[model samples]
Target chain A: MAFTKGAGPHQRGLTIGVDIGGTKVAAGVVTPAGRVLARVRTETPHKSKSPKVVEDTIAGVVEELRRDYTVGAVGVGAAGFVDDQRATVLFAPHLAWRNEPLRDALKARLDLPVVVENDANAAAWAEMCAGAGRNADDVIVVNLGTGIGGAVVIGGVLRRGRHGLGGEFGHMTIVPDGHRCECGNRGCWEQYASGNALTREARELTQAESPVARGLAQAVGGDPALITGPLVTELAQKGDRACAELLEDAGTWLGIGLANLAAAFDPELFIIGGGVSEAGDLLLEPARKAFRRTLTGRGYRPEAEIVAAALGNEAGLIGAADLARDALPRWRQGRRQRRLSRSRESRRAF
Target chain B: MAFTKGAGPHQRGLTIGVDIGGTKVAAGVVTPAGRVLARVRTETPHKSKSPKVVEDTIAGVVEELRRDYTVGAVGVGAAGFVDDQRATVLFAPHLAWRNEPLRDALKARLDLPVVVENDANAAAWAEMCAGAGRNADDVIVVNLGTGIGGAVVIGGVLRRGRHGLGGEFGHMTIVPDGHRCECGNRGCWEQYASGNALTREARELTQAESPVARGLAQAVGGDPALITGPLVTELAQKGDRACAELLEDAGTWLGIGLANLAAAFDPELFIIGGGVSEAGDLLLEPARKAFRRTLTGRGYRPEAEIVAAALGNEAGLIGAADLARDALPRWRQGRRQRRLSRSRESRRAF
Candidate 1:
């Protein structure tokens, strides 16, 4: 197996990073320093129940990229739970994958080493390494996409839980018996603090054809489900008073949840990313206010900075490729060392 | 500095550990193995505003125990925020201590090395070393006292946060705009799941003169304010249905908060300690049930064990002394090494 400490001037080999979303597969040939040197995009075979079609699409993307660049390894960040070994996709709600060994399959087919990771974890790592969370030992990345996805880093190490299921921030039950969530729970933080929440609130108001939501209702032809988070964000950014107000309300909920996170993790920095965070201060201003107001022992402790992710939508692709290039070898080495030590102890016992 | 890796047969020196609570000061001479050789207790000079009064009381207890054992060092676990250096008490709500240099003052007067720590951190360390969390690399100790207190260890290192205020678990907001908390927030976890919360519920029931609280009201002579957490625990243990129901409520809240924690830290074990934990499974069973139900991605992740602390109330004193004997020197050495490396780097630049 190829081993490199990190990105060095002489060892700047390229790696392919693939982000498999619900609708599309976005692939990029990322430089060792996390720069996307080249890119490719293809629609996901979403209708296929078989995992083969999706794997084939990923392999095709890698082969297409391999034609242009001498890639070392491939990192695929899936919107689902990745196992601790970074070798399997345990589950993906939108994709036709469950307990899928995507890494080994891709490795065998593409003839390149592969690593898999949860998309949010990849994004957070990108921010920590080459974006807003640079130089901070502890960081939390709140990816405010369709749902409020999260990733945590403590003491410069990603804190994947005992079963590699840590950073499920969106599903944390913030309010008991409150709003119903898709995850069979009530009052989950995401239910009240995400893109879907913002759209849901705005869409609800449009049903009344109220003066505040008149423009939104017209834009979506009076269909509440047709309203997207980005449309609301665009409307808010264009100085639409009602959309801004809606964003403010969602931001406040975001801030309250962030305060709860502050009380628990005490991170040095919080990087806000994803489609919703693109609204910038429209979403963050109220969040900042709520975070300060709700933070426990606010006056006594130093407050962590809440900033937008610098890498934008490219975070997952960049972070995944970098992890494949840098972290994968070290992780494999550590696992081998543990296994070797255990065998040595067992031999001594005999 | 006398440096020791950890407790071992070769380093069998005794240390004096003092636990300064709101009502009293408890002191103990503890061996390297965490055995309390001699114990002392004294009423706190609560009325005295002078720091000297408390310092003198602590010294008196140490002197009394010194007559019985040959001690090497002293450790004091203050029921408040200890600075990152573990040398000063920043601000204790219950005690008259604000930026008090307790370690230096004790070291000067006692002529022995002294280490100070947050009482909850001390207890958690004790549990990690000698009790329920023994052999666990990652652990979370939820100390349920008047309010909730917390300590976390991850990857074999105590997570003290960037500002030495990491384990403030009591303040995590579970209910948005619910009950008003003393921390100027509404619906803090401690407001719902603590000894104070238990007593407050019982008192409110007594105020209504309800049939359910009739036995508890009679236990305190009908004076609701006179009802303490221990009194309620005793009543519940003796088969008071109302008191047991109250405990169940608190346990449920505790479990919800634990689930939230699992989303964040995901430790392998959670050692429940402090005075209220003495109720054992009466409090824990409900907590465990709630923990499983509320846990995010429950079936997908490994459940952390929720066990009672074995060292009991003596945890604070014993842990503090052991930390003084073992962790202090290592911490000091680390600081010294960092300082040396920084200076060396600067010198090399010239």
Candidate 2:
């Protein structure tokens, strides 16, 4: 870990950001400039069916990072619905968390000021502050992973909506009774436009033993189950016609969904992030074409620019740390006020 | 005109609100409580092919209203894209308004403070302040008319988006390649769920002379051309199963779109307004059911309440008047400052 020394007065101390995903817990000591000084990673105890186990895992990573660098606070980005107060995880689909007070639990164990946020929101904030959305005040960050995750930023503020469930763009129905989603709905946008969609279509083609999918079949050794989103993307990047066509199909779906978002949000820009975005223009070109064709009042209105996110997978942790840093002054002031009130009460009792 | 005598200090004076539509121009003198004190209606000069004709019509209505009531300012709610500054009509599909400086034109002609806004945005602001969305902090108003129009209010402020074109919900593509829309898009939500959709379907059924169309055909005197959205709604209200089925289908589409909005906005309430909304439970019951079924994180998240709008057609004008009133103080101060600056410049010249 190479630490950038003397990060100016405003930059102050470092903060640790933990990204708690369904499969792994990744933590990093992030500077004010969104640079990571040190990092630690561990597998999520999702199989344990204990929220405490996940909390313990997050604490362990923070402790590991803190051993080397003195951090001011910890920010945890969980892949779940976080409360507006950013104190509890309301529910996580792949984790054993049901109304879990993760922030309080982590703060108690780590003995530091902590903030909790939805992973998508964290990533969006990171992008807005340091990446592709740096100059845009109104942006929508779309994360094209297994399923789609989204965060909306308007007027430079992250909009969590009334219930902190805003920006669940993937679940918006694109086709009526089209494809059944894991969320028990039919025709979700993600079912057609996400990484899962990309891989699912490729796998189905290979499974059918289609001549068009021969290259993909041979790459995965004729095992359809071995086909993955990244494998298809890699093949496409290597100039595989079949893989490129599949990506084009997904890109088309992606554009249609983005046009729908434009109607609803009319954002200035859309930052496309997540793992699948690594395909770059191979994915964005088709999406952009579809968006232009499908956008409402295309010529009459200023169309929002759709671009790839600059930050990689580390955006979530970086944003979480930045958010925690932004909240630090208030958190410290609150703690000081509480201590003063407690002392006054004790004096009165004496 | 019945004036509530001795209104409180805060409710001093009256303001005029003008609603410009494709077919008609409606203006009203509104009290601070969102009440219409007086009204005047005239056909829109859409055939003139001149933006000045529309401005003249707006000015004529304001002058007529001013004769009966002493209005301090005027607000015009145009059915087009209003700029973020509320000064220009960027575009109106129905009217000859392309980059029309409507506010300055109206201000010059009427010699009163003027504010121009999107009609749907004006209606949404009205609902948020004094109608169905009253007491709600976050609201989305869906106007189900010939086509759907929408406005979003978040944290009690109307969000007009980066380019003041945020709520074009009618144009969002619902079906991949279903119905062709007049807006040059295929499968727009309005093509499936709006007033035009209802009438078009009813006309199709009647034109095909199907057994299910007998009742509707008889009602429209065996002419499919006479079929209208309101006619079908009325028949459905009188217990016409075929007409009821049509409304139910439209309602289902409405609910699905609402569910999609919930995923993106998570507003506290969705106030349904416009012509088709008069169908009441005939349209809303099925829509609510579809919304509940299609909403993402259905069991975990708080669902926004979908309800009929409180104010009727007068909502646009009422909201416009209220918005004008809200901007009155600032407008007055600006004029005063300008006058002061002008006098200072003259003194310096002397």
Candidate 3:
């Protein structure tokens, strides 16, 4: 419970943030201003069937960060559905976690308060606090990674939904029966708008040996398998027409989905983040145009601004750490209640 | 400023609820419990270019109701967007209300406090207060009428969005490059799952002179132009397989959109209201089945319950009356402030 405090809200002391992604486990000692003072990284035990292996990895990183920073609380952002209580990982598609008590496990290891959050929610919090959505109260953060992930913040509070399963924007069907999603649905927004979509289209072009894809094929040494979302973005940035067109296609899908979001939420702003957003204007310009063309009540309504995320990859860890700090008092109170109940039970046993 | 007050929240005094639709103007003297004690209806001046005609019609209904009951406030539920201030009708698609000062006009005509709200929002408030969504803190009410309209209530408060333009759910795209919508967008959800969609399909079937549509064609005396949404519902309820199948198709599309809504809002319950909901389980059973199959994270997440709306068509007026009563205090305060400012200006002139 030993935590430092600064003059302003954004200048509060340190907390360790652990971001558990499908491929990597990244941790950082983040300040209240969303700055990472210290960091550590390791591969995730993504293939492990036991949840304990993933827990151990997270504990290792926290322990390493805690050695130097006197952190108050730890926040672990995971790539899955975190329960409403922010304690358990209900189910993770990319990891071996099903109803895993992630917060308690990490708290027991670190001897400090801990909170579990959906990675996208964590990223959105970062954007709301210190990144693209800084001044906006009602904002939506869409993470365009391997698959799309998203979060909604309304009236300056994150809406986690009745079951902490809200903001699964990527899974919304854009085209019925079009492209099959990993979630078993067809024509999901992510299937057409995420980094996966960009990489898939680039590979398809190179595989077809289309004359238009010569630049992309040469960049990948004529091997379609070598093509990735980042590689496509790089070529697009270097003025490769085929690669640029692929990004535009994904961006158009992105805009269409955003328009749908506009109809549903009517948010003030949309912050686009993750790997695909690195393409900058190449991805966002088409998205904005499509959003304008597709939005309902287009002429009558004030359109929400679509902007690239400011915090980039560090948003997950930064937001996680900040959220843990914010929840420290509540976590402490819960701990005290649990301890009191335990003592009462011991007395009864006597 | 005269108003009635009752003992309980649900037993508040009388208010007049006016529902302004594209074709009709329905008004009722409603109780706090959402019961309509007295009612009135007239065809809307939908073709008139003058906003004053609609206001005058609403005034006529209020004056008629005043003869029997001493109502406290008046609430108008219009078919399009109401501003966040609850004072203006920003832009209504079905009426001649472009940035119309609806509340002021109604207040002036009736000599009472008035509040204007989106008809869908008003219906949702009614459902949340005394109908299907009673006791649910977070609920989404989707009105499947000529086109879909929706409202979101979270933590028992209606979320009107930053611009009061939220919950335009029908405009959300369900198909890419699919049916063109009157809103100048293609593939809107309403194009697939609303009463208009149902009527259009039924008409198309009969117009094609297909054997399957023989029952429907005969019902309308071989004239497809005479076919309407209610007629189709009546046919389906009477055990017509073709009509039932059409409803099932719309139901499936309804469920897909609901799944998308679940992904975004994660409400505990969904109350399906409006004209199309009159078909009951014939429409809802298929929708529920499709919702279960198409929901994101499927078995891993808690699915929202989809049920037919209570209070039927009267929901819009009932909800409006209740909301007006709730907002009475604030309206009075605003009036007092304006009066004080006016008097002060007169004093300065003297």
Chain B TM-score for the candidates in order:
0.89, 0.91, 0.90
Q: Which candidate, 1 or 2, has the higher DockQ?
A: 2
Q: Which portions of model 3 show Cα errors greater than 4 Å?
A: A1-13, A330-350, B1-12, B330-350
Order of quality (DockQ): 2, 3, 1
Give the per-residue Cα lDDT of candidate 1 at A187. 89
The best candidate by DockQ is 2
TM-score on 0 to 1 scale for chain A of candidate 3: 0.90
Task: Please estimate how well model 2 matches the true structure, expressed as its whole-model Cα lDDT.
Answer: 0.85
Name every residue pair that clashes in candidate 2.
none
For model 2, give the TM-score of chain B: 0.91
Clash counts for the predictions, in order: 0, 0, 0
Fraction of true contacts retained by every candidate, in order, equals: 0.50, 0.73, 0.73
Among incorrect, acceptable, medium and high, the docking class of model 1 is acceptable
What lDDT score goes with residue B177 in model 3?
Answer: 90
Residues B316-345 of candidate 2 have per-residue lDDT tens digits of: 998888778645775442221122233234
Q: What residue pairs are clashing in model 3?
A: none
* lDDT of each residue in A154-211, candidate 3, tens digit only: 7766778878889999999998988899999899999999999888888998999999
Q: TM-scores across all candidates?
A: 0.89, 0.92, 0.91
- Model 1, B1-350: lDDT tens per residue? 12235533223467888998888888987766667767899998884468888899999999998876777789998888777778888878777888899999999999989989889888887777667776675678999998888897765556676556778899888988878887899999999888999889989999899999999999999899999999989999999999999999999999988988887777788889988898898999999999999887667557898999999888999788877774345433211112223323432111
DockQ of 3: 0.36
Query: For model 3 chain A, where is the 10-residue window of minimal lDDT?
Result: A332-341
